[model samples]
Target: MSVNVIILNGVSSSGKTTLAKAIQKYSHEIWLHVAMDSFIAMLPDGREFDREWFPMVEVSREGEVLPQMTNGPSGEALLLEMRRLVRGLSETGFNVIVDEVAEADTIADYRGRLGNGCLVVKVDAPLSELERRERERGDRLIGLAREQSERVHNGISYDLEVDTHAQTPDALARLILERIAA
Candidate 1:
């Protein structure tokens, strides 16, 4: 038997994870939250100190704060595995929800990897709201969301787009479910 897959792409603290959880809770079928954060957490101990993906921040000419992401061999390999995991799980009839912080190039890669069967949702919040959530969460880089906001959704054709600040996660999940049904 086949199952559904949902890829929720968004910046940090934009509520992708929250929405993913809500989707899982409301869905009749069991869903695995296979997220980028889970892959990131698998990196070796020193990675967070010296080998982190976004090691630092840079300010753009327009003064937008941005996180600089660098992927060495290890990071790249983990990402490859993450994509494979998503494909493998869904193919084996497990419903999956993936939350990611993906840019245009990354989204393109996913488009090819996930094929037409996956529902790609663009999750976002206002910059102010994103920053607020980031601060409240207290785990992410201070300006990562602001920097990611500049280009995260650029040039991708999404199946659905939801604003976390505009509605509760349950409402957004229902909207996403509706979109999937359509």
Candidate 2:
């Protein structure tokens, strides 16, 4: 049997990781979870503010301040490489679940690069719920959900849209499995 790829896209704290973990735990196939956060974490710290490296800027919207990470040249290259790595893994017969924030261009890139056999899933939660989750998590920068919620799914379409606020991760994973099985 050929390997399959599932791309879980959503804003910060929207439960993509949770759903990915649930899928890995419940699915008979051993799915490798490739998270953007883990790849980003691999980058050296203290460069997030450097324009030539990974520049993150603070922007205010509706009286709330948010940190927006700019995909500068370096960041863009890293993202492309990450996408390629995921594709390569899948080509090598490894099932892959990619958890990422779906920026418009990034979605397009994945669509073009991965082509068929890729199931794009939108893991969603209301902006208010996302903000609450972000706060509760406390590991993320303040207002990241707000910033990402505004832009992450722009111009992206999905085979499945799961609402984390309404569904538990395990339930969502089952739904995803059913969809893939059909």
Per lDDT, the best of the predicted structures is: 2
TM-score of each: 0.90, 0.93
Error of 1 at 80 (Å): 1.2
The clash numbers for all candidates, in the given order, read 0, 0
lDDT of 1 by residue, 2-102 (tens): 22788899988899999999998888778899988887777665564345352554667375546655565667777878888888887788888989987
Tens digits of per-residue lDDT for model 2, 78-152: 878999998899888888999998677887787777777688999989888988888888788778888988888
lDDT of 1 at 74: 66
* Candidate 1 clashing pairs, residues 3+ apart or interchain: none
Clashing pairs in model 2, backbone N/Cα/C closer than 3 A: none
Instruction: Write down the worst ten-residue block by lDDT for model 2.
Output: 45-54
Q: Which stretches of candidate 2 lie over 4 Å from their true place?
A: 1-3
* Candidate of highest TM-score: 2
